[model samples]
Target: MKTCNNCGAQVEDVAKFCPECGFKFGSIAEPRAVVTDMYDHTSEFSPEDIANNKLYAILMYCVSLMGIIIGLLAAGDSPYVRFHIKQSLKLFICEVILGLITGALFWTVIVGIVGGIAIVVLAVVDIICLVNACKGLAKEPPIVCKIGFLK
Candidate 1:
């Protein structure tokens, strides 16, 4: 087992994310600064370009599929918009699957309530994603980002 840097949680050696805190495991133990550096070092895109698309990016978080459609149709040309839309789409799908599983488990009162709370917490994370987008981070939400693809 490996210890997660962010939360100090023990994870399976092959785990891609920290189950406790959702810290993404990169080749190096701590890659937060490295990733930011990589993005900052890029010369191709201007930060202002990302800042300009903040509205659509926030919409992507709040509107789910509708946000994705708008982002794809109107802001596809912008990488920042596309990135947030993809993350939003991922969250929407995750929510549906989670809802189905939780709904079935509702016979257990505690499980139902906990699952419902989890769903609401997940939704709240999207709000953080929205704020990040407005701030021009455009990074993935902690849990959704670590999940890696719709699977």
Candidate 2:
């Protein structure tokens, strides 16, 4: 028997994923390279660029469209800030569209529930993007990455 690291549950040694949390184990488990790749964008910008513009990048996520404008004016030359601004822009647009849809369909209970959940998810993604900016990384946010308008 072995303990699953993810959920702290006991499992058979031969099992590939934890029964309690579905966490992959051993050789089949998620690879370090893939995990690193998911957040790796340091090579795209210089260290100085990341350091200088990280604050403006973070602001873009915190203040929505207004933050994007601030970031553009403050750190327009920084590739690092620009990257985060694009991610923030994508999220802002999605939020606007979701809000409009939910408002129009406010009469339906199902739309209200689903829209509320989606809004929560977008908020979480915004936090993720803000954290990435704080870390000086340019990782594209999940779900919002699929938006093709701003790229």
Pairs with backbone N, CA or C atoms under 3 Å apart (clashes), candidate 2: none
RMSD of 2: 10.8
lDDT of 2 by residue, 1-151 (tens): 9988778899998998888998889744545564556545767789999888888988898899999999899888878888887788889989999999999997899999999999999999999888888888888888878665777
> What would the per-residue lDDT of candidate 1 be over residues 1-151, giving only the tens digit for each residue?
9999888889999999889988889856744554343222123446776777778888888788888898888879987776777778888988898899898999999879988988998988888887776676756676776678952
- Assess every candidate by TM-score: 0.65, 0.73
- The per-model lDDT (C-alpha) reads 0.77, 0.85
Q: Candidate 1, TM-score vs. the true structure?
A: 0.65
* C-alpha-based local distance difference test score of model 2: 0.85
Best by TM-score: 2
